[model samples]
Target: MAQRIRVGIVFGGASSEHDVSCMTAGGVSRAIDAQRFEVIGIGITPSGRWVQVAADELRDLRKQGGTLPRLSESRPTAVLLPGQAGGARVATIEGDRLTDVHDFDVAFALLHGPFGEDGTVQGLFEMLGLRYVGSGVAASANGMDKDLMKRHLAASGLPGCRFVTVTARQWSQQREQSLARIAGLGFPVFVKPARGGSSVGITKVDRVDDLEPAVLLAQKFDPKLVIEEGVANAREVEFAVLGGRGGPPRVSLPGEIVMRQAGAFYDFEAKYVSDDDAALLVPTQMDEELRQRSADVAARTFEAMGAEGLARVDLFVTADGRVLVNEINTMPGFTHISMFPSLWAVSGVGYTELISDLIDQALERPVGLR
Candidate 1:
């Protein structure tokens, strides 16, 4: 029998999206092929401690009592070390003593947001010479920062809404100048933490009177903020991109996010907590020509971001048929209900197969400077 590849499923992080990452890890843990891969759960505590977790412990990760699940620090502390041959090794430490150590072929980092998705962990993997899923360091970092992402997209000639960035230094030292720049974009702008995900620190301001408070709220998550001009009468559509085996990336059928509530955007609660607040329309109805155009743009966005393994590209489709790049999520939400997996499922790839494909792609990818 062929040897089963040991896969390190790293999830849970110090980011505000920690709960979401745990949820994603749970989904992947349950769906990953048990026959072909040996799963090792490495959960990171909210306080930034890495610990070993059993696959079964992560299976039931979900919201309870109106609170999202979090990783427990009680599990044996875990650390990654360089292996003798190449790859990486997972070592579990109990108290002051080393408990167990195992070698992993590839790291499937299911972490979202800052410490994980923003390329910090990817850089660690690069230094350790460990092949991992998703984009490389530069791509992941660019994809995480909304300001940088928009700049890259614009430089690549992708159509998008006009946006202005507010750095912490500028906001404090040159408040008047920052306000003037933002005012140029007009009202009804989205104030968002430039490096946040899961819509954790985003506020849609319809008037100038509410801008300061919104900026304050976003600044709590990230010192830098990217306030974007609102796209009027636009439909939120997303496409999932999977790296092709020694070929161009594959694009999935488009999916639409329909918020049930009036005047409400797809906020954090609407995304994970209250399912009734929004509906995910997979293979959402679209004109053939428009669909092709949007898909092509989504693929371009992925390539422009230099993403690998997988990513989800979000676009704003105006009523006048203009497709604008909203943002690209290098490590999008991956729960079963998340749009990334849902889009692929409708595109004929099941959840299990999708997980397998990502791992296979990561394993096949070259480690260190790709």
Candidate 2:
């Protein structure tokens, strides 16, 4: 029999989305083939400590609010040595300094937000000469920041939202100047951390007066900020693109997010906490013309960003019926109800099959300056 591949499931990151990352890791670990791959859970606490955790324990961590998962309890811990070229390695620390070397074929970085989802972790994988899931370093970095993403999309002729970058230094040094620059873009704008994810520090400032404090709130999360020209009552649509053009990439049926009674927008509460704060219309209610156009935009955004494997392209349908790329999630949510995997599931790809397909892509694709 062939040796089962060892998978290092890296989770828990030093970002606001740390808890969400744990949830994502648990969902992915549960779906990964047990007979095909030996799963090892690596938890990185908010303080950056890399501890090995048992699979069941990882799931239990998610149910901190008096909920429970369907698994027995066991705690596992491991240590990660820092270096990319020698490849990622782990040591099982048990008892009084007793250790054993445990290597994995590839790592499943189920990390979200700044430290993990951004180019940081992917850069390490590049140096280590290892295969991992999601986009490469450049793509990961671009997708993490809304400002750079818009630039790449515009340069590639892919439609995107109008926006400007506000550095923390500039905001602090000349608050008036920064506010003037943002005012030029118009009011009722979106103030977001340039390197944030999961909409943790996103605020919609309708009045010019509210803009400064909004930017300040965003600055708390990241050193950089982005204020985008708000798309007025634009329908929030999403389309999933998988694989690359070398082989035919599949576009999942579009889904629409209809905010019913949530925060002013889809904030952290609406996205992660609220059970049914918004209505998600899958295979969205769109005319064939708009549907096809939305799907095309998804592919274009993915291509323009130079993405590989998979990406969830979010768009805003204008009042006049044009689709504009909001941003791309190179490594989107895979938790049970998350859009990334859920869209594929309804589009004929099961959870287990989706996990297998992603691993297949990582294994088949070569790791280098490609």
Candidate 3:
């Protein structure tokens, strides 16, 4: 019998999206192929402690009652140590004693938001010479920052929503000038943390009176902000992109996020808290030409961002038929119900096969300086 590959499923993080990450880990754990891969659950606590989690424990990660799941610090503390010959190992730490050291082959990082998704963890993996799923350090960093992502897309000649960036220093030093630049985007702008995800720190401002308060709220999540002009009469659609094996990246059929409530954006609450506010439609109806155009743009966005393994490209389809790029999620939500998996499912890839394919992709890639 062939040896089962030991896969490190890294989840949880010191980000606002930590709970979401935990949920994603649970979903992946449930769907991943058990016969071919040995699952090693590695979770990071909200306070930034790495701990080893059992497969059963990861399976139980879910929202109970109204509370989202969090990693318990009580689990044995864990760490990833550099291995000989460009590989990695995982071991548990008890006080000052290290034990249960095991060879860890590939890392399926299910972490979302800052510490994990913004290239910090990727950089660590690079230094350790370990191959992992998702984009490399530079691509992960660019995808995490909305301001940089938009700028990158623009430089690649892609269409995006009109927006302005405001850093903490700039906002404080040139308050009036910054506000003036934002005002140029007109009212009804989306104030968002430049590097935050899962809609944790986003606010839709209808007028100038609400703009500053929205900016302040977003600043709590990230010091830099990207306030974009809201697309009028636009439908929120998303596409899932997966790296091809020795070929171009693959783009899935589009999915649509339909907000059931009037004037309610797809906020954090709508995403995780309430289930009735938003409906996910896979293989959403679209003109053949528009669909092709959207897919082309999404694939281009993934390639231009230098993303690898997998990514989710979000786009806004205006009623007038203009398709504008919203942003690319290098590490998108992987829950069974998440749009990324749903899009692929409709595109003929089941959840389990999708998970297996991603692991295979990671294993096929070279570790260093790729």
Index of the highest-TM-score prediction? 3
TM-score of 1: 0.94
Candidate 1 per-residue lDDT, tens place, 1-370, comes to 5899888899888877788788888888888888998888888998898888876887778677877789977776789998744478888877787777888888999988788888999999888888888899999999999999999999999999999999999999999999999899987899999988778879999988898899999999899999999888789999999997888789999999988876789899998679699888998999999999999999889888899989999999999999999999998888887889988999999999999999889888777776
Misplaced by over 4 Å in model 3 are 62-68, 84-86
Candidate 1, residue 87: the lDDT equals 71
By lDDT, the better pick of 1 and 2 is 1
lDDT of 3 by residue, 1-370 (tens): 5888888899998877788889889888888888998888888998898988888988888878968899877777789999765558888987898888878788899988787888999999998988898899999999999999999999999999999999999999999999999999998999999998879779999988888889899999899999999887789989999997889899999999999987888898888779798998898999999999999999999999999999999999998899999999998988898889989999999999999999999989998776
- Which prediction has more favorable TM-score, 1 or 3? 3
Q: TM-scores, in order shown?
A: 0.94, 0.89, 0.95
Residue range with the least summed lDDT across 10 consecutive positions in model 1 = 83-92
Per-candidate Cα lDDT values, in order, are 0.89, 0.79, 0.90
